[model samples]
Target: MRSLDSAREVCERFHPGLVKALGELTFAEREAPGSPVIDLFREHGGVGLLVPTEHGGHGADPVQAVRVMRAIGSMSPSLAAAATMHHFTAATLYALAPTEGRLTGAQIDVLKSVVPDRKIMASGWAEGRTEQNILMPAVTAVAAPGGYTLSGTKKPCSLSKSMDYLTASIAVPGPTGEPELAMAIIPADSPGISVHPFWGNDVLAAAESDEVRLENVFVPEDLIIRTTEEDPERMEALQLAGFVWFELLISSGYAGAAAALVEKVLQRRRGSATDQIQLVVKVESAFAVLEGAARAVLDGVDGEEAVAAALVARFAAQQAIAESTATALELLGGLDFITSSDSARLASGVRPLAFHPPSRASVAEALIAYCAGDALVLA
Candidate 1:
């Protein structure tokens, strides 16, 4: 509980009253559709948690970000899950710094409102959980007068209901007149933007992971961010940076849910001394792995190396969640299961981490090859 408490303190420091606000709501209320968690998140300035100080954000470092994510995760898994999408999308804004000359004026204008207006961003990239490759573009861009028209669907898109902007991955025309991967920032209220039900589970229903369909959605040219011909690797690097944040923050959220169950077990002293110690060891060790990866990024690690670190943390946290939660439920036994639904809800909230993008199965081979002195290429 010391680590969780400390992590929560960090969250409190960054976004005052956020944890308390989330705590005020019942788990059932927070997990239900039409949940007020997103509203609370916006009011608490959580939409800008990852934005930099120059951009009117908290400017939390990698360590602080993960800590806040864990604290938030402990309270509302759905909020943490949905917030991960928004936070990671905001994290990309750092790479698009004005000095980098990578952002268009229109893109900068929309991003400028993110922190001040508490606008939520939904990720349209990383749709590869259903596709064969995780990095494939999600939409097709047809050249139009001003910019382009896009048509596609991102299923299970988090923050679908409340998002103010959608950061989409699309295949734009290249110099060879072929499809090249690029990112487009589309306004949520665009002519062809719509949302429909897709998420059927109640585990993290508050996340609003549903289908976001775009049909002939017109986007201005200035809102599109593309890789320079001089540096063709720019787009891949951008995606990799996003992947690192995604892996660390999302995994921490699930870890927080599992930690909540562990806290319950520790409080009631239901398990034996040895059992409690093992629970702490397993959970803490998993968190240490996650934090270690975060620290690595802070220590100037980037590119494939940073992504590899994040994946290690994510997979390690996944295994720990599986083992620790099962142990917790067993110690809780039949009575707790019947008496309180919070324990089950908290435990179930963490199970979906295994299903996020860049899954263990998809990247195992690439990681192995990278360890053998090969470039890490995620297919």
Candidate 2:
């Protein structure tokens, strides 16, 4: 129901401030140790900027969030990744959480209208390793009186250091031997919780990425959002669907980066030989691809249809951004590689695309699964 126009406006309003502080701010440097964008977003209530007014948020829609994230990702992918992580997580809660009690009528309105003003939360579904090639988190949760105690390590959390809250998957060992996945909201500073920086120097400089370890961390009953005793394989599939959505949102950020890079290159190319009709055609087509991806995201289709839409959008946006960045770099030559130029900043921004969720292999497999249907089995 929401459009990107208002969101674009919000991004435009904040662009100047963000750009002005881009270099000097510690968070702007992907390799730097601070999280400048997250700080600024919180200071400006950036999440609240687009969040609705009902649940203490601005009642902002997904389009607005997506557009703003794209803008940030254009300038700084690290910032975009951290800022948007929770939105997808929130979407998961909205889509899967029980529709009664705390998520009741008025509360639901607030959530849909203005999302809850809870501390920032991120999902921790991925496990550290896998047996039989299936990744499962080493952390597990055991039932306690009021809630469950969660313990395990969640690595490379986008904004782990700066977030106030997180939703981690706990290994709930069932009566049957197999474990169940349960989502819980945990405070960032809870005792027995440790944060360790994990992202490498080459990735988003502004990223405050860290690995979170919960050792008997207590999650109150109210914090437990969802639990299912359904087939582990089936539940895993549903979880994958939610994860796919998050991946799609992230890819859109790259599209935004591509658009920004094009604008930066165009400014200097005017009256130059590089601005030929063919070149213009290539660039314009690239831009169109990104815009189409954005459109699919805003359309709000449901189920596997939504997943398919997101996958297509992500693939298109990635291709366009890869092309746009290469073109912009080639056009700028020496100047583009310098850290001072917007070209350099954007180049760095696009680097994160190499490692985000639903990785290349995962995305490819997901596409296969979607196309082949459940009955189609692998040999």
Candidate 3:
């Protein structure tokens, strides 16, 4: 695992006061129903961790971003998960924008305001769906004079209740009247936008993973992102970037949760020396894989290669985290399992890592085919 100093440094560099504030909150307070931890995070610029520095926020590189996420996960996995949505939303906007040409004034203004206003952007992308449908929009957008009226529901939208803005994927009519994927950025309070309780479980209630419904929600033309069918390469690149960002950050968050479990076992000295050594090795190995993957992303490797590396790294980390957390639970014994809420919660929290995009079961065939010299195609 990363050194504590290194994790602290990442947090200090990107969000100076955030670590201290999170440390001050008890686990109960952080996970309580409608926890105020999100508000506290916003107060310390946590929402702007991935926004560019020139835009008045931290422009952390991929490695730094993952490190900060791990730190947050150790303290509060719910906060880490919610913040991942915010950071990734910012990252997607920047990644999808043209590199050299001038951006529309409205788009530029929205990006700039994210940090200054402490805006929390929720991801309204489809989730809990199969990997084949991951990027496909469940919502449809009807063409209008100035913009499109969108109607769809994104279930388990993180930060649904607290977000100030939302970035969603909508199916728009293409030139041939065929459904094509398009992204829309709109205010959370837009007319006809509503959030309903859909998470239906307490596992990550603090994340506010509710359902966001859009009914004839008009998204201005300026806020739309769409690529022509002729530009397959650009669309591929955009999707690859999203996958890299999502897998890396989500893995880091769960790694932190697993790390917390290890810490508790060590603090209590309940496990034997050999057990401690074994668990430490597994946790460290997972972090090492994750760090390597993050470095590949920051180094700007070929898009397809980077995506492949992220998938491999994420799966390896997932296995290690599962083993480490289960081991830690056994080492902590039944008494601690029954008496300690943090221990039980951390155990449950680590399970979500397996549920993130590009599930191993869904991509196993493609991954094997790629290893045997076939083209990599996730969908």
lDDT per residue for candidate 1 within 1-379, as digits (tens), equals: 8888998999899888988988888889988999999999999899878888888888788988999999988899999999999988888756777455777778788878899988999988855355345467888889999999999888889999999999988888888987788989999999999999999988999999999999999998998988777778888887888889988999999888889889888989987999999998998887889999999999999998998889989999999998999899899889999987878888899999888877788889999999999999888
The models' CA-based lDDT, in order, is 0.88, 0.58, 0.81
Q: Candidates 1 and 2: which is better by TM-score?
A: 1
Model 1 steric clash pairs = none
- Model 2 worst lDDT window (10 residues): 127-136
Question: Clash pairs of candidate 3?
Answer: 1-284
Candidate 2, residues 294-375, lDDT tens digits: the string is 4664675555665566556666566656766777677767754665555666665775665554455655765687687743
TM-score for each candidate, following the candidate numbering: 0.97, 0.77, 0.94
Off by over 4 Å in 2: 1-8, 12-31, 49-53, 96-98, 102-118, 127-138, 173-178, 228-241, 270-300, 336-342, 363-366, 372-379
Each prediction's RMSD over C-alphas, in Å, is 1.2, 5.3, 2.0
What tens digits encode model 3's per-residue C-alpha lDDT throughout 1-379?
Answer: 3454477678877777877887888887787669877887899889777777677877888889888988888878898888888887788787644454434677777887888888899887765555643566667788888999988887788898999998877877778877767778889989999999788666666888888889999989988877665563565466567778888888898888888889888888977899898998998788789889899878877577887888899999999999999999899999987876778878888898877776898889888988898888877
Question: How far out, in Å, is residue 116 in model 2?
Answer: 8.6
**Candidate 3: lDDT of 65?**
86
User: Could you tell me the TM-score of candidate 1?
Assistant: 0.97
Best-to-worst order by TM-score is 1, 3, 2
Question: Which residues of candidate 1, in runs, are more than 4 Å off?
Answer: none
Candidate number with the higher lDDT (2 or 3): 3
Clash statistics: count for each candidate: 0, 20, 1
